[model samples]
Target chain A: MRLIGKEEIENIAIGAALLGTGGGGDPYIGKLMAIQAVEENGPIRLLSLDEVPDDALIVPSAMMGAPTVMVEKIPSGHEALAAFKSLKDFLGQEIYATMPIEAGGVNSLLPLALAAQIGLPVIDADGMGRAFPELQMVTFYLEGASATPMVLSDEKGNSLLLNTIDSVWAERIARSVTVEMGGSVMNAIYPMEGHFVKKASIKNILTLEEEIGRTVREAMKQNINPIEDVLELVGGTALFEGKVTDINRRTEGGFAKGTATIDGLNKNKGSDCRLHFQNEHLLCEVDGKVRCVTPDLIAVVDSETGMPITTEGLRYGARCTVIGIPCDEKWRTEKGIATAGPRYFGYDTDFTPIEQLNAKAGITK
Target chain B: MRLIGKEEIENIAIGAALLGTGGGGDPYIGKLMAIQAVEENGPIRLLSLDEVPDDALIVPSAMMGAPTVMVEKIPSGHEALAAFKSLKDFLGQEIYATMPIEAGGVNSLLPLALAAQIGLPVIDADGMGRAFPELQMVTFYLEGASATPMVLSDEKGNSLLLNTIDSVWAERIARSVTVEMGGSVMNAIYPMEGHFVKKASIKNILTLEEEIGRTVREAMKQNINPIEDVLELVGGTALFEGKVTDINRRTEGGFAKGTATIDGLNKNKGSDCRLHFQNEHLLCEVDGKVRCVTPDLIAVVDSETGMPITTEGLRYGARCTVIGIPCDEKWRTEKGIATAGPRYFGYDTDFTPIEQLNAKAGITK
Candidate 1:
């Protein structure tokens, strides 16, 4: 186990937001909460998935609802711990550690914050290597893990324990409750034994976040191209360097869905790129040719600062660098493609590896 | 304790529908479920509140959501029991009996159905003497009862247990969940001791329902005026006898709200009455004069059959009789009026007793 202090939280938040791929919710508030928790309860221990005992009980946590709402109605900071305790009590067993449901945005910090507050260790792995909109989109779910016996808590000391037959139903029910609990809530779900956790989780995501975050920060400090550093660290390729020209967004069935157009700049000056998103950036097209789709990371970052821009924060006129990175090998499996591929988002295309797409376009470094 | 059999469910359903005042949802499905449960598990016992032991644990049950949705998605007949078992496990205490959260429509029969299925007795009382749209509008809430530690369950074996600061928050949170859970679910709430149950509940509402239902059914069979029999049985007065000339309705924020205009006929010809409602009928104005408002009962029944007409079922050109009955004395208390009076429903007027309004209008019989 490695000790995680306040400084590391900033790095993780930055890196997680990058992996968030324009969804996951903003990380500033969650970062502050984690900082406070660590200050009060001392540093948290970060444990590798392999280090956990085979019988150790693991609980993954996240914040569920509209990201826009979270920005306005700040959490009470106690909801996560409340949900954790409620679930622990329900199980009548001691939880060995806490883990992130997804390695993206604010949720990446929630489990860390909860672990610090409760004096527990956070697992180094996560359910999703990158963010997906729904609860059932996690690798744990695809690997046959159930999200039942979930606990949901709100700011006003209100908590609900949910049990569903499947993870999809868990998402559907918890989502409804989240909307009712004033549009946002903290949830503890996917309780599992260490054996299952080791098999289902995306290993070493915490380390990857730290590496990505540190690389970007150092590049920014040195006045180097932060985008180039991020691309090198994540083995990504710059898909488009442009200024956002237009954005059209609407919330349907509790999801923010939209399309954004970006006018290419500098070397690729006359071309245009478009992004289609449902919560997370799902598809990226350059001059009407699809370059990347879901299950492959499509990140839009600030041109200068290299900070990830959430879908809710996307605005016209912002200069951005869009990058495409290959997802973990686990997500390339047939089951994984079927779970979160282009077709799942209602597009008529199959999963195409980002590397192949980038090489075919002959725009390599 | 008194035994309740399948035969009595019809009478209670009829009377409870009248009490629903246009909302609480249709009672036909709930009544059928109750009949099936009784046939399968034998007759259920109905206990007087006074007879309950001081420490007896009583849990009230009800169905919450849009009445329109309930019609399309029939229940799986196991949600209420699922919620009950979940809550029971959480409380870690033996539940003594079941009771209705309200004496309106389907909710009135839920406790009976639950009791029959579980072979437990049902209390002969309810939280609301007549239906009100919100969970916090119950007499129990006005009497200082908390709706926390509540359990909500859907037909898919999904359950949620909520703990909130007060009943209002519980309602707000539960209503949101209801919408998410396909617009309706069963809830078991306000688990109180026997002593509190007796003080908070509208006593003997089950008996009242049976009496009102039997009176109406018998009058129809005997070729007597069913409307007159209903008014006499409930000590109500004829507010208006008319043909439904116009009906306008809309659902807002999950509640069915609307207005109906009736043209007076026969002895009451040459005048019109208008009823404004939110879930339950909240106000009635006859000949441009306010005659009855919330904290009183406003019921619309078929002119010929004396069958209660729900707000969702109100159609233009239907011949109807409108009646206003005095609410239970408990509802006239300052706290009760403040909880569900005219002003509570956004009306500008203070609550005026139905009897006084009838007297002023010179329509006493």
Candidate 2:
């Protein structure tokens, strides 16, 4: 087991944003809230999946709604804890610990804050090693765990407990409630036994985030190429190094969807890449050919600061480097591909693993 | 206590539609469902408010969303029961009776069917004596009863339990979920003790509906003027007798809003009346003078048959007779006026009781 303090929250925010692949909402407020929670309640204990008892009851949680709205609305800082308490009351069972629904952006830190406030430990693993747009896109859902008996709470002290037939329906109903609760809400879902959490979760995602975050921070401190260090540490390949030339964005069906064009520079001058995103970066195509797609991480980081740039923050003239990392092996299964592959995103091509795509393009790992 | 047989459903439907004031959806399917439930589970018992035990648990329920969508997507006939069951499980108490959230159109019969299926008696009182667009418009809400600990259920077996700060928030949040759950859902709300139900509810609204329906049907059989009989029975006044010359309608924010222009006929020829509505008729003007406003009933019925014409059924060229009836005494109070009067519906004029309006227009009741 490990303990998460003020310093650890900063690293987790940076790492989570990178893994968010441009979605997962802004991590700044989440980081601040988490830091405050830790400061007020001392350090939060983080338990490894293996350390959890078989009978332990764990519930994963996060914020649901438009990230843009979240920045302005700002949570009451008690919505997450309220959702946890309501769920605990409904379940009539002693909740052993809290877990992150996804290891991306703001959601990565929500559970830590909730744990600190409620005097509970947070499990180190997560439902998604990286962020995906919908609630049902988590690995737990892919492995047949239901997201029902879920609790959604808002800043106004309003809460709802949902019992849905399946994970997809859970997403549909909860989303409607989220929109109604002023366009955002905190949710505690996927209540399960420790055995199920161990089997269905993407293991050690918090540790992965810390490592990725530390690698970039150290590289920047030493005045080395932070992008290259990030790529090497994650076994990812550099897709592009360029200045953003154009960006087009709009909200459609409750999601931020847009495209960004980057003109390559330095060693790869004259070439350009296009990134298409819906909440998260879904695909990357260089020149004309598709280089990477969803289920693989497509992270955009500042060339100088090494800070991850979310889709909501994309703007013209930002010099950045894009990297493609392979997803967890569990997401490469047939079910995973069916759940979040290129076709699921309305793309015509089949999902080609990020590493395979890089190797085919003659980019050495 | 009284027992309602299958034969009584038709009268109830007719009366409920009249009280709907051109909203509350169609009562045909609801009538059929109620009759079927009665046949399947024996006659449903109807308990008067005074007969209810003080400690008995009472739950009021109804269908919410676009009435237009309900015609296309017929329920699986189990959604209401599902909502009741879920609420029952959550409360973990012995529910003694069911009640209608409103005595208008489809909702009037929902509680009867639920009572028959669950072997519980249905109270003759309802939250609303007449239908209004929002859930919080009910008399229970105006009287300070909370609509929380409510359950919303869809035909697909998805259920949500809401615990909100107040009745208005419950409506706001539940309406969003209803829209998301394919534009309609069944909800069981306002779980209260029998004593509270007696104090907060619009008493004997169901019996009033039955009386009005029977009077109209008997007048039609006897070849008497049914509209005049309806006016006399409800102590209402004949506001206008005309043919619909123009009708404009659209759905906004989940409620059907529209206006109808009527050209006066017979002795009233050479004049015109305009009826404005949002779900239910909220205002009426004759020769550009305000004749009636919400909190008072504005019902339009087929001229020859005395059958209420719902907002959904209003079309150009339909010959109709409009009537204005006084609202329940409770609705004329300060708090009641604030809840569902002209101002609440965004009308510029203050609420004028139907009797005063009729007297000023020289229309004797």
Candidate 3:
């Protein structure tokens, strides 16, 4: 285990925003929340997955609802504690650590903030190496992990403990309840024993996020573009270089769903790219041809700073570089693909590797 | 204490339907569920509020959703047991008895069925002496009794335990969850100590329901119209006698909300009556002038047999008599009226007691 102070939180937030693709939540807000928490309560302890004993209990914490609403209805710090306390009481077992369900945007750093305040270690593994919108879109779910007994606690002191037959049901019921609880609520979900978590989780996600964040920060200091380093680190492909032209977004069914258009720039001139998202980037198309789809990471970064931009922060006329990182090996499996593939998001396409799509376009760097 | 067998269920169903005031749930379905439970587990014990020890725990069981949905999606009986067990476990104490949140339609009989199956006593008291759509529209709520720690269980082995800041929040959140859980779910709610039950609940509500049922059944047996006898028993007035002409109904936001129009007959042939409801009848008018409005009770019964008709049972051509009963004294106070008054249900009038409305209409009988 090692300590994670404000610096670590800042670096993690940048990487989280990139992995978050176009959704999850705003990394800046996540950074502020984590920094304040660390400042108030001291550095947090982050344990590697291997360090957790088999008998230890780990409950991942998250915020569930539309990312749009999350910005305005900031969690009151106490909501996470309330959720953890209620879940721990319900399980009648002491929780050994907390972690993020996804290593993306705001969710990746939320557990760190919570750990600092609650004085618990945050496990370094996450269910999703990046992020997906729904609760069931996780490697743990693909491995047959149940998303409940789960607890959702709002800032209003209202909480609900849900026990569902399957993870999908957990998603449906919890989504509606989250909407009712005013768009966003904190969750203590997917309580698992360390043995099962070690088997099911994508390991070293936080460490990778920190590396990516540090790479971007150092590159910016040296007046260099960090996209090349980021691509090499994550085995990612630069899909498009573009200037944002238009965005159409609406908050619907507890999700911020929309399509964003980016006009091509630099080497990708004369081509236009369309990115579709529901909380996270789900599908990306360049010149009307699919380049990357869900279960694959699609991130947009500032062309100059290489700083990741959240979908909430994506405005028109921004010069950016869009990249596609290959997802974890676990997500390439049939079950994983079926759970969060392009088809699952209502796109009429089968799962295809981002590298394969990149090669077909014949512009590999 | 006494035993409640099939006969008692039959009588209570009738009276429960009457008090249900055109909402609650279908009486026939409630009777069948209770009868089956009694046949399998013998008679259920009936305990008056006075019989419960001061510190004994009481949990009321009911079904929440649009009445229209409850008809098609019959519960599998296990839902209530699951709800009760969950709530009992959460409280970590043996529940002394189960009661009804409302003494109306299916809600009134659901507790009896659950009592038989769980072998717990059924308290002869209820939060609402009659039915109202929302959870907080009860005497218990007026007395500041919380509607949670509550458990909502569905037939699909899903359950949610809720703890809200207030009863209104409970109603808002639970109602949305009910809609998501296939539009209906069983609930164990408003847990109270015996002393609090005695203070907050409407006493002898089940007994009153039974007496009204007996009156209607005996009147049918004697081949006489039971409306007068029923009126006398509940201190109600015959509001209008008519044949159903027009009914507009829609299930929205987990409630069966609509209006029904009746063409006058006999002494009231020249006039028309209108009834408005959101789960229960909340407003009644004759030719545009307001008559009986909630928290007063308005029920429709078959003119010939004097058998109560649920909102679900209201047919386009059914000959029916509309009756208005004075609500329990608890519902007449400022808090009570504010909780379920005419304006609360979107009617544009102040609450006028049924007696005053009836006297103004020259229907002293």
Candidates' TM-scores?
0.93, 0.97, 0.96
- lDDT tens per residue, model 2, B95-191: 8889898867788987888788878899999987889888888888877889989998888888899999998899898988888888888888899
Model 1 chain A weakest 10-residue run by lDDT: A264-273
Better of 1 and 2 by TM-score: 2
Which pairs, if any, clash in model 1? none
A68-159 per-residue lDDT for model 3 (tens digits): 68889888777888899999999999999999999777899889989998999999989999988899998889898899999999999999
**Residue A269 lDDT (model 1):** 27
TM-score of chain A of each: 0.96, 0.97, 0.96
Interface RMSD of 2: 0.8
lDDT of 2 by residue, A156-233 (tens): 899999999899999998888888888889898999999999999988888878887887777778877677767776
Candidate 2 regions with alpha-carbon error over 4 angstroms = A268-270, B268-270
What's model 3's TM-score?
A: 0.96
DockQ of each: 0.68, 0.87, 0.90
Could you give the candidate ranking by DockQ, starting with the highest? 3, 2, 1
Q: Which pairs clash inside model 2?
A: none
TM-score, cand. 2: 0.97
Instruction: List ranges where model 1 is wrong by over 4 Å.
Output: A226-229, A242-256, A260-271, A301-320, A363-365, B226-229, B266-270, B302-306, B312-319, B363-365
> What is candidate 1's lDDT per residue for A120-192, written digit by digit as tens?
8999999888899888888888889899789888887888888887888888878877877878888889999
